[model samples]
Target: MDVAGAPRRFTGQYYEQGRDIFTDVDQNTFKAVGEEPVSTFSIDVDTASYGFVRASLNRNVLPTPDAVRTEEMVNYFRYKYPAPASREQPFSTTVNVFPSPWTEGRKLVRVGIKGYELPSASLPRANLVFLIDTSGSMNAPNKLPLVKQSMLMLLGRLDADDHVAIVTYAGNAGTALPPTPVREKARIAAVIETLGAGGSTAGAEGIRQAYELAAQNLDPDGVNRVILATDGDFNVGITNSEELKGYVEREREKGVLLSVLGFGMGNYNDALMQTLAQNGNGNAAYIDTINEARKTLLDEATSTLFPIAKDVKIQVEFNPATVAEYRLIGYETRMLKREDFENDKVDAGDVGSGQAVTALYEIVPVGGPRAFGERRYGTRITEAARGNDTEYGFVKIRYKRLDSPTSRLLSTPIDRTKEVASFDSAPRDARFATAVASFAELLRGGRYTGSMTYDDVLKILGKTRGDDAFGYRSEFDQLVRRAKTASSMARLGS
Candidate 1:
């Protein structure tokens, strides 16, 4: 799956024009369970970071350290977790504990949330507003061309009853097409084909117009969403990320969500894309090739366009008597305060139909190899957990149904019942996730990976590729090799 178009040096960083913006985030550190036993973070289903990393590798460059988001990388590939019995529950949670392949005496705890899958016939009408960027910066072949084609791919997925609208911005914003039924597919495609790149970017205006269109055509029973396709270059009108996020949030409150599809390289603004998506109650994805467009728009059409659950938050509390230390593998930015889980006013990530979001934690059990020494003068371990000493942790999830503002809670315990005999005996999905997380960690300087190497990553990937019907996991194998090459090239300063 050559998701990146024609390669430059590695993939997404061919130009090196030095305008790509990614927020530098620090790696998570292990904490003694006795000190802070609770871990809280929102569920992230976005795959933008993985696509960006792959694009960089294809261009012969290893991704910038900040560009390697372990959570997005780990969540990019679909895992075969069991679905909820019904939409009433919305999602199912799966937990597994296995030995950490990277180091001895440590273990990996996997928490997976698989959203309920809905048959196409059961989905509500889709009210989609295509907010496209036609800025001069998007003139590159991979930018606007792919954006237009990506729109077509999504158009092909909509039902006749679905509605489509187009809003584009360069120096200014304008509607290329009004809200039209998918029954008029030819009209929609014709409008998309006519779109071209030129002039400065007025992305904020484009978003406003798109959201307005969606709002005006609000379907009480339909899923209304604004899909923004851009290089994330907002050169004109309300370029401030916070302001734009606030704007998106306002519209989200009115029932119109946003999803950003980033394209191109060098000058991409992944940070802004994330801000918009995160606040707009949507997800961000990068499309570097037609294959990626297909994966995001066609193959995962329902999941990409119709969210089944919103404001989903996960909290895990380690039993101090059973676990000594633990640290989350990714989602550094989505971390929430302990009280946010039950707060309906607090915003969190949304889960789409059939979307599976997985999170990993590296933990040291009591009497296991500890990452940090016991707090010499800290509070002593208590007997409060005496009855729960057999449990490694407790997992709690809070989520709201698509139509509700109130949240509900679901929980399960991570105990011996969830532990695998060894890494080799762990679920393939869990192993594969760990492999991806390890690879991402290596790319980000391997602060915690210790002796893990590309070879080790390949070893894990080789054994856990599963029956990758879509070849997604097989693609990861190639990416690992590409990363190795890119590392060598970087060392030589090629």
Candidate 2:
């Protein structure tokens, strides 16, 4: 124990509705127990409200085949915005990696970019319906009220040519405003402001009404979407999970995208929001503050409204000889089946135009013959005498055009014999990603093979801070200090 009276250890975790309980064991390990163990989870290193988890695992306790995907892990790294190649341009790639807090000599990888390729936002006509949940649960200061304010902000940003509608749900769903041109800003603001919170949550009915409004106002060449803002609490109608997923999936086929912006806390359903966004061919974001709303709706406006690639999947094959044992840092839930890479129907992440996605792998150099300590040498019997002349496997990416189902493939070779050390030759984005990953591990309980710590992670990140254009690097350093202090406090608590 060092300072703040918290335990310095990773014992285990037990999570339930609205609360997470962690037990301290040693400084290195933890286990989750309560309300079932969630596996697929997304965390915000900056804002703490929008954490997502899908803990569905089989009896074997390993992540399901469809649950693990490389892109999910890489996309999960959210540090350093991709720089625009030029002030006039919109997309640039940035990569960063920092030392792992749990694993010695290993690093966390981050790849990101600011995408300039704003899809043609010039939709001939856009029919946007807002599905809002105004239940009593959303009475908090940051709940429905903030949502309304945010919508108003978006309304202010709309063009006169765009069409907008509003649908609200409490015990039942109903449309408060019909489709109208952006010229009627006053009327739209009036309708939005009049929305009040009451009754129990009826998310399904709201979804139905929003989709109906969208389908009725389908824009042949414009953007037709149902933007659902809720805390994902469904008590009245259409509560069945699979049924809702199917409904949203079918609606997506109509060329109407779904964008889910989750608001509020307490009983927040990250799983439900994720499912809705994934199946609806859209993205999910939790709005904890007004700044987040501005970032999502205003700053990254084009990408949020238009997509460049859909169903993006990444596949990386490692040479058995070059890497002894490897594990993905985060995205423990988005792992993919090896064959699923070629399957087009498999749902994957979407990449906005000019968006830079990055992933990293901790590998052991084959040429150096590093000390692996024979962890799995005798665990499995030898199969048909595989040769040792293997080289680095290929890294492949698959993505479909925003409006098409067919996909395109991009592949790059990973030279096995080259044995590049990540610490020395890592790109800028890689270094950033590494720092983010390390920071995440340190924040959560990281029990890794590398024996990395928060102090080490900060050192690595500081060296490759890059241009610090958006102050993200400065923010990162602050987070590092906070984490270090928290760890010390936890130690003291123990």
Candidate 3:
């Protein structure tokens, strides 16, 4: 119904982009400590990948490997890392090194950071622009309807002083509701109900319009953000993710940020959503069901809406004397040049209040089993200074205060002091995070996870699934079960 260079519009039933888009992820490879001693990357807290993977498994199908980002999947689960003492530091960093669960002769290092939570009474006012995509592609029950419910759930977390406006894009962008205080919540809900889906997607135009409106009422004293809720199918003008990425970057300079809430499938543009959110000084979440909506918007409101730190970067230096080789388990897309860590001009990920981030590295100790194969000429290994023998590596983290232009530094040594003798003896949260990383790797065809199967993941889940009051872990247990079933079905050609 549409030509090559022409935009798609609704016909009798629907004329939507009928395929999902995901950026293919090439798993990180092992690096010889002597060859590349420092590993640097940005912190990521987006949980969209896990929810999308679960949605796929719920339909009894394996998710496309490209859609499974191990970092996002692992970061989705909560971890009880120690919080910071005060807002001055904003967050606390903790480390634990334990034996690997899947592979022998390799150590798994856990780097954990927990942001300090702000009390409800101490939180600032909020100005939010609800940039809804009411394109024809959103006609499904899971798209526009779920988006309306999500906005209402998020609204419950806002203070009475907070203001909200609605902007929508279909054939073109328009302002659906002017900025209004939460005191007129009923009126806002009425406007949300009136939204209907049709026309070609005007995603890029909607972003421009939303940013303009957010600037007119930008709340410098509080949070100013444009929340884009869509299936991520940008079919009309300015559809390229790279172009949109630049616009969002420029818009972020004016103090109005962007966060994306992705909905639906078959037409999801995850790659574009990720580019916009990453450059917009914000995070992304996927809403598959009402429970997930409650979890992301209601339970995690404090963290999701208020950022305490921005442009967060992490650099870890592996000591050749102690560590022979190392590989970051996930974060394939977030890898940054080592020089980028110290450059304040380079934008990075942001951290929110009470949010926890976890990263794992698989390391081979000096003279241990090397994945890159043994060196030629049989060179002597114990040749480094004795003083540095105790430390495996040094971790340096740089983050900017939410309102500050300059960055601050936090560093610590990942030494034997942080190591536990046995994997079971490690901190429960660390062990649980390791399980998540292992499960994620296995889902992506287990290229690095040797011989590890679903049963192995289940065993790890059974032990490390700590006080799961929200039942998220229990839900994960069910998902793993479904994945096993799906895998069996696929193998049987059913």
Q: Per the 3 Å backbone cut-off, how many clashing residue pairs does candidate 2 have?
A: 61
| Alpha-carbon lDDT of model 2 | 0.58
Residue 41 deviation, candidate 1, in Å? 0.6
The whole-model C-alpha lDDT of candidate 1 against the native structure comes to: 0.88
**Structural similarity to truth (TM-score) of each candidate:** 0.95, 0.75, 0.94
Candidate lDDT values, in order? 0.88, 0.58, 0.86
Maximum-lDDT candidate: 1
| Best-fitting candidate, scored by TM-score | 1
Query: Could you tell which candidate, 1 or 3, scores higher by lDDT?
Result: 1
- Candidate order (TM-score): 1, 3, 2
Candidate 1's TM-score reads 0.95
Candidate 2, superposed: residue stretches over 4 Å from native: 1-15, 19-116, 119-125, 367-391, 416-425, 484-494
Question: 1-494 in candidate 2: lDDT tens per residue?
Answer: 01101231222221223221111112311111111111122211112121221111111122212222334323433445645554233334343433433445543333343444653553245578988889887888888888988898888767887889999999888999998888989999999999999998788889988999888888887777888888776767777667888999999888877888877544565556666787887776667567667766776555566665667766655444334444445544344566677888887766554455555555433332233444443333123213433443345666676657887765544543333355647555565566665555444455453566777777877777877655646655765665454443322112
State the weakest 10-residue window (summed lDDT) of model 2.
Answer: 30-39
Candidate 3: residue 435 lDDT (0-100): 74
